[model samples]
Every structure is written in C-alpha cells, then in structure tokens.
Target: MLESYLQVAEVMFMQVRLKAFIIFCVYTCAKFLVKRKCEFKPFKMLCEFGWILTVLLILKITGITTGDFGTTSVFDGNVQISFNISIENFSIATLLNLILFIPFGFFSAGVLKKLRSKWIYGILIGLIFSLTVEFLQTFIGRFVELEDVLMNTMGAFIGYEIMVLVIKLKDRMKMGALKVE
Candidate 1:
C-alpha cells in the first residue's frame, strides 16, 4: 500500500512538472512572438514537438515499439512472430490512442490560423497524422489497427472542440473586462 502511494505521488509530481514545462514554453514563445510583431499563432516548433512527443509516449505505453523481446520470439534471429489481438485489447488500445492524440488536437487548434473553421482543419490533420503513425508502426514490426485511427481522430476532434470553447470563453471575458473599463 505504501509503495502504491509512493508511485501515485511520483506520477502526480511528473504530471505537474510536465504541465509547468509546457506552460513555460508557451509563455516564452508568446513573449517572443509578440515582441517580434509576428503572428502569435501557436504553430511554432514546440507545438509540433508536443504532437510528436504525444505519439512516441503513446507508442511507448502500448509497449509495441519498445523492442521488448520478452513476449516476442525472433525466429532464427531474423523475423519476429506476431501477437494475438482480442476485443478487449483492441478497446484498450483504441482508448489509449484517443487519449494520446487529444493534446495534439488541442495544441494544433491554438497554433492554427485564426478562423472559425480551424477545428475542422485540426481534425483533418489529426486524421492524417494518425494514419501516418499507423503506417509507420506496421513497418516497425508493431501491430497496427484501423480502429486506432478512428479513435485517435475522434480524440483530436474532441480536443479541438474543447480548445474552441476555451477560446470563446476567453474572448468573452476580455470583452467583459473592456466594458468594465
């Protein structure tokens, strides 16, 4: 029980640190962009990096591309045998994929140009990105599922919608503040 508690604490700490780092990066980038009179879109390299990191972390957590040969057997040290897939496994994989792509969608929306249809653009990009990842996984001796693409796209769409909502809320607050002044 104590060990579990420690693990939970460590996880929480890591999450907080991750959030802080992301916030810091955004703040610095915003400052730079504003000072330079550049478009303050979030389409910087850091946002792209965040998307890539999300993909890698998802793959790592799924344990498919980790080169973990314990459950794998390389026949004659040349070919890797395939693993079985079940409905439950597919469901879990789908859920994880969806969760993994949410950040990408959210960040992409922020980085995209100011347009009411940016969320649609984000969804399309997310779908393409997910397809590319799935294709790459196939070449890497990892199992690729069509369901994962659907789930990831759905996740990205939902995330983009949330971002849109947040932006609207922020605009409203700003307008309200201006009225007060």
Candidate 2:
C-alpha cells in the first residue's frame, strides 16, 4: 500500500514539476520584459517560485488534476462530500491533509508581506484555499470533507508559526554575532 502511494506521489511530482517549470519560465520572462524599470529581487522571486511549486503539488496530490470533467457525470454518484465534523474521522488521511498544507502556509507567509506578522491572515488564507479545494473536488468526483478544511487550516497556522520561529532565531543569531563583535 505504501509503495503504491509512493509510486503515485512520484508520478504526481514529475507532472507538477514539469508544469511548474513551464509556468515559472513564462513568469520570469514576463517579469523581466514587462517591468523593465523595476529592480529584480531574487529573494522575492524565490518566494514566488516556492509558492507556485507548493500550489501545483497540492493540486496534483488532491486528485484535482486527474479528474475527467467531461466524462464523469456529477450525478453519477461517485462524488462524495462529507460535512461530518466528528472526531472519529481523524485518521491518517487527516494527518496527511494537515501535512499537505504546511508548505503552502510557509510559502504564503514568506511571499505575502502582510502575513508575516499577522497569523490570522495566514489562517484565513489557508481556510479559503482549503474551502476552494473541497468545493472543486465535488465537481471532480473526489471526496470532500469538512475535517480536511479544519486540519489544513491548523496545518497552515503551524507552518506560519514555524516560519515566524525561524525568523526570530535568525534575528537572535544576528544579534549574538553583533554582541560577539
């Protein structure tokens, strides 16, 4: 079972990487061409690249990319939307959902200037993204769960906190270095 999951993940990673590469190339070219007067910021570009990769990976892993919209009828009954807010639903899948959004939150917090100091914005962004995914899943014949949204939001919050911690640690290290001088 684990091997199957790994294989699927490998395939998904390849596909997302290809797509992200093309998108990034176009984005980079456009930025260079369109904003000739603006100075390039490598750090900002890196953050944007990370955000793109993270979103592409998330979309691929969520089965949103694999769905055949034209062939599968929405009423065919394969579509499952669970609004169950039960503790019993907390399982490996829930953990995976949480883990999946951590990178999203981290990148979002890094890329969006407003999200750096304000954690609420991060959580809200996570919630909105999760809700959008879940809603889109219904049309794609994937199972949509409310628990996933909750877990994903929590994961985003954790990721944001982790980024904040890292920033603080780096600042402390800089301070220490100055003191040693």
The model with the greatest lDDT is 2
Clashes of 2: 0
Enumerate residue pairs that collide in model 2: none
Q: After aligning candidate 2 to the native by TM-score, how far in Å is the CA of 158 from where it should be?
A: 1.4
How high is each candidate's TM-score? 0.59, 0.82
- The global Cα lDDT (0 to 1) of model 1 is 0.63
Q: Which ranges in model 1 have alpha carbons more than 4 Å from their true place?
A: 1-90, 114-118
Angstrom error at residue 26, model 1: 13
Candidate 1 to truth, TM: 0.59
Per-residue alpha-carbon lDDT of candidate 1 for residues 97-163, written as tens digits (9 for 90 to 100): 6776787787667666452374567679779877776655554456666677778888888877877
